[model samples]
Target: MANIVIDRIRKSFGTFEALKEVSLTINDGEFVSLLGPSGCGKTTLLRIIAGLETSTSGDVLIGGKSVIGLPPKERGLAMVFQNYAVFPHMTVYENVAFGLRMQKADDARVKAQVEKAAGLLHIEQYLDRYPNKLSGGQRQRVAVARALAVEPKVLLMDEPLSNLDALLRLEMRAELKTVLQSAGTTTIYVTHDQTEAMGLSDRIAVMHNGVVEQVGTPVDVYNYPATRFVGGFIGNPPMNFIKVPVTNGQVAAGSEPLTAPEETGNEVILGLRGEAVQLAPLPLGLEMKVRVAEPMGSHLLLTGSIHDQPVRVVLPSSETVRSGDVIGLKLDPNRITWLSPESGKSFPAATA
Candidate 1:
């Protein structure tokens, strides 16, 4: 296991700047995910770390040693590509043993290592089968076993689960976590899926436009976002933002007044997660004409406009509501997040 450090990394492609002074450290044996949407420079950053792409200017350190000039094979890292790059002609045993064989390991050593890795991935029974014979999930396990057979100091995965079906992906997420924990190897995963990052990583690096917006646990980034972009990007349905006016130290929105922190700006954005908005008794809340109501299994998602600004609320599916109906909603002031309109940054809650 090794600690990986990225120092002041910047990348530029012709007239386009792909990365902007990005830096972060992955502690030994920690599982970190680089998460963002497409065109967000996450894959570029991952490629740079793997020595597959050189940075415009930066230093990459593995285990406290600089590897700026080393080739990918010399970096002592194993990479699992998105497509599960296993040779079609090779049997599972041969594929798992490929790295060791390349290093000229004897037959006995190769066999032992291949068996160990295959057992770890629960594919020992199909060792003699070719890649063409394996299912998508099985092929994925083979790819992972191949990487693990080499005992890499750091494991790099580039959206390894993106190709799997939804249920298979969920199953593999749990399995991958267990595999990495048992191996105790440092791993960095890159993906645009928020659920994958939230469920799999010890820490998530939220990237946007080639820059890292925040680095923290999933709960930290989701509950207490560092920027408006982070707040809007990290959640499942995303957060509802409303620019409400402040009058006499109280924010005016909908049909209610929410007390603002002292010394707040004239206008602030009130961010509300879906769960924070709820149906209420008719006499004491904002009245909104429902524009859409989506049934999501256990919860109902209600989309409507309050004060001409869009708002969404998540309620229990048992509640009766539909489109074109006026529904009363109560906002939880305690769950509200205040944001600065000018800078698009969140303001810390007032000191009580």
Candidate 2:
């Protein structure tokens, strides 16, 4: 009943558009992350849903009813921000109790909800301490505990772990996923970190330049990106791109022959993950003049020029190749993505 449907939401700040007719749905008890680089309007859309910012056009609905005119509190949702937004003067217990208190809940209910939220966030031990006394991670827990104490229909988190250190950020990221799923609050999270989005979301809406480029499960977005931007943006070291000529419905990469994609064109951009390439024998269509070799514990990454495009490839660490070596590549034909060079959309050459 708490499912959220964002229906063609648009937002503008004078001459600049922040969200352009973006639409998405977050099922009840599901976690959906708005993910993209900075300035993609993810946060703007989140704020619009929270009613902290109004949409210039379009509607927002929760539980199948439009909430366009509702204030944030009236919409039955809670938001956790990147800054941890805790009051310096209040003890953790009081902070967690604030939302319930605002609702005029009885003291007993407030105490119970605050205690429950603190337990969920694992901050019970520090409830009596002020924000200044807590670590960065602990302060964030207070912020989350405060939000959860209200038992909202939907939870919106905006980069809530960004301020933490790298290791702490990882820890909190996993913890948030587990805790939020347990709470089952129908969460919508906004983050520019792909790893965070991948780890925390049931689905991710990838945004770009005020528009959602794609919306899919983490696996779908990673393995079968909808746009060329998404294919290059989602992966670590990212998906590689090289323009190759097509002849007789087949791709001739320097010397190796690739089965033609279903899309009819004289040329198609070959999208390959670095891990998809394997060292093979002669007749390779592309040549990488290795200029950099990185030993990545479990794998080796080589970066160089191939088909006049800069590319990186991953290989098993045991491989002995180094800079100046020309490693022949045999691409896993089934693993390749065929993309239209003109429109940048995938050619649907393969099933998801």
Candidate 3:
């Protein structure tokens, strides 16, 4: 395992700055994910670490040694791309052993390591099958096995499960985590999928427009987002932002007044997760005219508008509200977030 450190890395493509003095540290044996939307520089940062893209400035260190001048092969790291990229003509065993062969390991040692990695990935039974004969998940496992066969200090994955179906993606996620944990390889995974990042990472670095927006554990970033962009980006159904007029420690949504703990001198945006909005029995509350109601197994997703602003609410499936229903929602101040109306900077309430 290796500790990866990126110190003030900057990269530009023509006039576009891909990475703007981005800095982060991945501890030895830690699984850290770089998460953001497309064109947000998460992939560029990964490629820089893999030596596939050169940084305009700054340093990349592996195990306390700078690898700025090293080639990808000499960097002592393995990378897996979005596609499986397994050779269709090669058997699973051959694909897994390719890296070891490139490094000129003895035939006996290569066989042992290949068998061990395949077993670890639970693909040992399919070792003799060619890629064309394997399932999508099996092919993905072969790709991972090939990377593991190198026995590198670190592993880099760039949206490795994107090509798989939802069920297969979830299955591979569990399998990949197990294999990586057993091997104890330091891993840096890049993805735009917030759920995947939250489920797989020890910590996530949320990026935006070539800069690091927030870097924290999933809970920290979710519960106490550093910016409105993160609050809006990292959640399922996403967080709802209502632009409200602030006055005397209270914010008003249309004609209804909602209580929050933020000072009222500045115009602030109110943020509430879909789950935090309570469908209450009160007569007068934040009024939302439901536009669509989707039953998602255990819960119902209500997409509607509050004074023409979009709002999503996740309620129990048993609640029998339908489209075009005007419902009163009780805002939970304890779970609410306040952000600068103009800057979108988040200000979380203090815990008692």
Best candidate, TM-score: 2
lDDT of 1 by residue, 205-246 (tens): 999998999999998788778788988988867888888888
Q: Any runs in candidate 2 off by more than 4 Å, and if so which?
A: 254-256, 284-286
Model 3: lDDT equals 0.88
Model 2 agreement with the true structure over 252-283: per-residue lDDT tens digits: 76576787676658988888888888787546
Ranking of all predicted structures according to TM-score, beginning with the best and ending with the worst: 2, 1, 3
**Range of the 10 consecutive residues with the lowest summed lDDT in candidate 3:** 254-263
Model 1 misplaced stretches (Cα beyond 4 Å): 253-257, 261-263, 349-352
What's the TM-score of each model vs. the native?
0.93, 0.96, 0.92
In the range 1-352, model 3's lDDT, one tens digit per residue, is 5899999999999999999999999999999999999999999999999999999999999999999979998899998888878988888899999989989999999999999888878899899888898888888888998999889899999999988999999988988888888888899999998999999999999999999999999988887788989999989888888887667877764346766555445466778889987786536567888999999889999999886889999998888888889988877767778777767887656454
The alpha-carbon deviation from the true structure for residue 307 of candidate 1, after best TM-score superposition, in angstroms, is 1.9
Instruction: State candidate 1's TM-score.
Output: 0.93
- Name the candidate, 2 or 3, with the larger TM-score value: 2
Candidate 2 colliding pairs: 253-285, 254-285, 255-284, 255-285
CA RMSD for every model?
Answer: 2.0, 1.4, 2.3
| Top-down lDDT ranking | 2, 1, 3
